[model samples]
Target: MWLPPSPGQIPFQQGIEAVSERFIGAPFIDNALGEGPGSHDPDPTFRLDAFDCTTFIETVWAMSLAPEPKEHWTDHLQKIRYLNGEIAFTQRLHFISLDWMPYHEKRGAIVDVTRDPGLPLAESLTTIDRKAWYSKMHPAKLREFESRFPADKPIPAFMHYLTFQELLDNPQGLNRLRQELQKGVLLANFIRPNWDTIKYIGTRIDVSHQGFLILKGDRIILRHASAVRGRVGDEDFVEYMKAYKEHATLKGIQLVRFKSL
Candidate 1:
């Protein structure tokens, strides 16, 4: 069982390290959506006992920021999990690049350095049609979705991503990316494959997963809730990237650095 420290018990970097380390070997549970079909409305829902990739990162972030995590994590979770601190499924950040990254940047919660000039060239686009997904929802849920997101409206969403070939070709740029992988920075996994299926059933975003960067001495490690490994674990960054290269669905990565407010 992992226990989180109170906010200010240490700096954000140390706080993230403490929480992530404590959660190592914790079971990976796909329960972020466990509230299920009709329970889409936001209500400070989170579970530290188990986590998916997104919830794992969100939980650690909330724990790091709150003065007393046990007492204030719910409020911090709400603020970080939803846009403008509005508790609606529609307002929740559904896309990493399109919704979460930029919103957090604007709020000074994070700094997105994915487009730094030295990195590999990236392809940018909007995806995951929320309206399209809503259309197929059960009529009852459809009404709820519509009330939050008007069907006639188009939501502006976008993503920036690099292909595996680009990453392999840009050694110097890859070095730059490695240099930027500091403790507490959030690393988003951008998977490339059938966008239609992903957009329809998955998170309406280019990013498929996320984790925190933990640089120990000269090595960079990713502290994440791994569904494949079935628990929270630390993976060497380089090895993790190479493993993804074998997967046809993998694209590349996007990074967000969380700064203390």
Candidate 2:
């Protein structure tokens, strides 16, 4: 999973704007981070040349959390990526609703704003059995994760989000959506298909993708590293979300924003 040769470390930057500007054109590479320096994939703890959806948000948020982010981005990433900043593959926040979001929420790092709009929302019923999932992985992976998987065991997670039609039916919700998007430093996570989008993988999941919500003037934008577009770019929030109508893969939107540190 390692890249050919990463460039030098990013010069210390203070806020998300500085870090965001530098990663605007990064390529979207899946499994971009590996258990480097000790485990699984060889990729380093951080890099700007490439990012998957979650890593882009993690890296940018890491930079945004500190006064002099360059010095602390590494450890910040660990805090965001793993529960209690435990540096282990098993402790990594693998599931968004179950592990990532709740861990951050408990620590006062981010506040889930999915319910802030007061839209007609519904809770997703997802059965997450990572212990079973790890058991099915290659023997070596099962050994590392099976017994210790799903560190927080109550994780057949249920999350609230605004479905496409629900967003349309509530004009008040539509208006609130616009207002929420305009608030910068926002993170938008896309909940997955209502049915079985990942049944082939033998895992059930609620969240599938994420990006930063960026508003430029009156235009609301989702600044994300797009795998379909092959690079990081700004996409019109409404036009991009139109995929919800075209494909069932996009079930809903969950908004999260960082708290002042």
**Which candidate wins on lDDT?**
2
Record all residue pairs in model 2 with backbone atoms less than 3 Å apart, i.e. clashing. none
List CA RMSD, all candidates.
3.8, 3.6
Q: Model 2 residue 243 lDDT?
A: 63
- What TM-score does candidate 1 reach? 0.80
- Put down candidate 1 lDDT per residue, 1-261, tens digits, no spaces: 555433444344347777667667778877553333356543228665667898888877877766664566667777887877776666777666656777788888787666763655566454555665556543446676677766544444555665555655666655565566543355555655334463345324456678877778767678899899988889987777777766755667766677743
Positional deviation of residue 261's Cα in model 1 after best superposition, in angstroms: 6.5
lDDT of 2 by residue, 48-144 (tens): 6789998888887777665464466688787778767777777778778778888888888789988887777877878776665555543457666
Give the range of the ten consecutive residues with the poorest summed lDDT in model 2: 2-11
Clashing pairs in 1: none
Model 2 compared with the native: what TM-score?
A: 0.86
